[model samples]
Target: MKKAVLASALSWALLAGCSQPAQTDQTIHQVNSVTNSSSVSDQTTLTAAQYSEQFIAELWQLYPEYALYVGYYDYDDQLPIANPQRRAQELAWLQQQQATISQLLETDLTDHQRTDLSLMANFVKRGIWQIESFKSWQWDPSEYNVAGGFAQIVNGNYKPEIERLRTILKRLEHVPAYYQAAQANVSKPAIPQTRLAIQQNQGVASVLGDELLAKAIASDMTEAEKIQFEQRLSDAQLAVATYIDFLTELLPEVEGADPVYRLGDTVYEQKFAFDIQSQLTAKQLYERALADQKMIHGKMAELTTELWSTYFADQAMPAEPMAAIGQMLERLSQVHAKPAEFKAAVEQQIPELIAFIKANDLMTLDDDKPLVIRHTPEYMRGYAVASIQAPGPYDAKANTYYNVMPLDGMPAEQAESFLREYNQYLMQVLNIHEAIPGHYTQLVYANKSPSLIKSIIRNGAMIEGWAVFAERMMLEAGYGDFEPELWLMYYKWNLRVVTNTILDYSIQVLGMEQEQAMDLMVNQAFQQQAEAAGKWRRATLSQVQLTSYYAGFSDILVLRDKAKQAWGEDYSIKRFNETFLSYGNAPVPVIAELMLK
Candidate 1:
């Protein structure tokens, strides 16, 4: 629940491509006169590079917070509100920039520049104007509170920055005002069940009330500041508590209402297009996912036979899906007797994983910035099966958190069974994705990229794609020393990808029932009964997000194969990976246009 605004400058870098070829003196002069005469310095004509630079600089001034997130330290304290005035101003700016880019496109530029302009124009339209008009206050208080509050606490403990914390506290103090403003300006549409509002409300109360308030009161601040912090904390706590109460009380009343507050088909299509820059419909993507599942299942069946023959030579492989899944779950549980033992094993394995990546040169190791894994906080734990929280804005140091929930409110046998399902090999697969050459590595490089613009528009497709790709890479790299159990773990990870895609389409597009989805999870993915039940709930709450990993990995593979074909003997794995990640976390299409050039 770390609230971070998209970085403006970094996003531009990722979006910018090579400019068009040199324009004739006449064309340059004509464009300069229509745009900005001042831009026509000693040079008679404006190059695409020069125009891109000027355009980005203007955008940075408009959205400085974006710059901060992208590693630009110049605008550390700025917060851009999505208010009416700001929205109007942003729209005006986008229109102006669009015109400017359009004028440049009319001139003679390289093919790369034309593609870059197309992306930039689309980016401005979708991101700036669309988001502005669609602004909802719900985003400010609820999402902002939980994301901002937890970020402060987590980072504050690791490295205390009193000034920044105070700024965040001031923001928290105004939460009521923001919420009130949102109520006044926007319609308080029925809360979407798909959103984690209930869980978020609970999280805000836990972190802001217990953790943040406790820290603020304990700090040696001026008496006035201490009192202000205490009062603000109290107000935040009440706001969150009341919201939770309201939601619970209204739940039964609204039970007959649509569970999902959808934007419907058209809006969903727009969002999909903006996110991936693809024309593929939801139906098309669903078919692809199903096809992939079928192919992978066939491969997994063969591999499972080999593994059972190797490990349990005397015993026949479990034929029933439930029995097979149960056996694996039992084996997983036997590995960790207690939480302490589990943590210790994780701690020992992380460094070894890091070392493996370094020795293989899969990615550059930031030894100066190590990753830290911990359990999910009590409040936010409900929404996520697992998550990774990046380092804060003020802190350059990188810390990666792995949040695993311990089974509670269940029978002892049930709890043990649940924990076993997430045993050693599962942990390793998670580690590869959350740490090592996955998120940690890619994020570090992204943070350090020269283009601040690329960092702000952080694409989930790239980040998740790299992690999913890394899981395959690790197995191929002889991770677990080619052990068949580990290979089974890899297939389990694949199952997650396949199930996510299926659930997204089934529930969101095909209108599949909850019970049917659960059945599919158990039968097709071999998910444990308890796990399948929980996943059904999660699928209802979060749609399409889970598909990002596999969707991204598919794109990455396409790009990788294209690179191999193009580079031939010149291709090097390290160079290809480095180049692929250099574009920041842009979508696959943007990455292709940026790097393939």
Candidate 2:
């Protein structure tokens, strides 16, 4: 998952969702009535269903942006000010929720209720850790942007144009105060994050610009109302500009300060637990990745030897395994779509994947939900090349976007290197991971999940791991007609996952530097220079996220093996997949416990 603005804890979507909850009559009443632990404690006597509903209501009040993200629109016009007072409030709410969930877990309950309660407890503990221990708000200025929340409202079809515009106008009123609070909260900020804040904020006006203005003007609202909306838009844009200026000016002041981006071993351990939620500890996961790396290299070498003559019949192969595999991949990568045809190629593969899933009876495919392919939004660029923007469970009717970054303006060499990295076979793997039977498919099932807790408190490891698992699963089920080239690229892509764990753990906890990191990616993992450069940048920008792929993928594959043994004659790929995903996006371990039971 791509991080969004204000994701101080875990991924961006995880925390940004908390920043934008809406306010309806029910929410306002809940917020006002539930002022202390006593009020929430009273709800514990209620049934699991009742208590969960009440818990979500209080949660929305605390993290309103999250409410907006999950399709609750009551507080769309409100933006939580990231000031000291608000953090204290969040701390108190989390402690109370933690207490209530602890008590609930002790009660007699069904499997589903227990699973949901456990997830809620995990979510609450993470929030508490964020406030008390991993306090990113104090040093990460990039966590303060407001453009994404507004962009969601502008692009969302949840409300009509005029209504959404009105929400935007009301929310825009707080832009100045929001940044004021942000500026006040930041202290000794990380220089790298400060620079990123400047770049991300520079595009804030896109969401508040002509497209929104045109909608407001065309709406049936009064002329005076339209004028008022335009004025607010201008102010919001200026607030964004002012915030960018603040970050730009603050850069030099902190350039020579301590390098605080590295979350040392102590904090890294705790963060990995909360974010990945895996059965293994950080050290164990790192060790497993190291072993997987050697094994994948061996597999890639075998494929390279088999295909060497097919691509280079007249040439002699390198004596070293890494060199031989690298040369073979370089030849295979030459066959790729042009930069202009990148997005079109991705778009064209969606239906093919859907058909394969149906023909093979892999899993049930939902046709009602539409997947819209588009360019990555301006404010969300500078991170990953592609991501999925799925509507929250509450707004299931809204379109799910497959966000591909356009290569239109990239330098020609950079674009070619990128295209070669994606290549033809790997591009199909990318589609499988990002679109059909991956994020888009998995997320659609999440929204349909009956348990609200499972759908909303999504685990990044499971989310990412499922995508990685889907890639391997598709190929094994006869995707690309069992081509060795596709398998070679698949192994190469899988190596990326293994090295991602190694790169992240080594850098954040073990003090790995740029040169060593590049050697691992380009020379060892066989990634192109362009792809390696992006991963290096991304590794610095995030922590524990890159590791999610291997952590989750390995855990999931192990779980499936146990299921096969336990289910015996009843085990089938479709049966295993549907049952696994049925738990929504709960952590892999949690899902495993429930599944194996």
* TM-score for each predicted model, relative to the true structure: 0.80, 0.95
Tens digits of lDDT, candidate 1, 1-597: 111111111132123210000000111222333344343222335677776666666555555433433334343333443345444455555666666677777889875566556656777766563444433233222232334333534354443556655755655564554333333333453444413556655655555666666667677666788788888767767766655565555445545434544344565555555554544665576678889887777666666666565556778778864455445544533665354455556667888897787777776677887666666665555455566655522355745555555544557766655556567777788777777678777777776665544554556666777888888987887778988777876787787777787786677666777678877887777666667767776655544555667678888888888888888898877778888877666677777766776
- Residues 476-586, candidate 2: write the lDDT tens digits: 999999899999999999999999999999989988888899999999998889999888877887788888888989999999999999999999999999999988889
Model 2 CA deviation exceeding 4 Å by range: 1-12, 15-33, 253-260
Q: Which candidate is the best by lDDT?
A: 2
TM-score of 1: 0.80
**Alpha-carbon local distance difference test for all models:** 0.58, 0.81
CA displacement after TM-score superposition, residue 255 of candidate 1 (Å): 7.1
Estimate candidate 2's alpha-carbon lDDT, on a 0 to 1 scale. Answer: 0.81
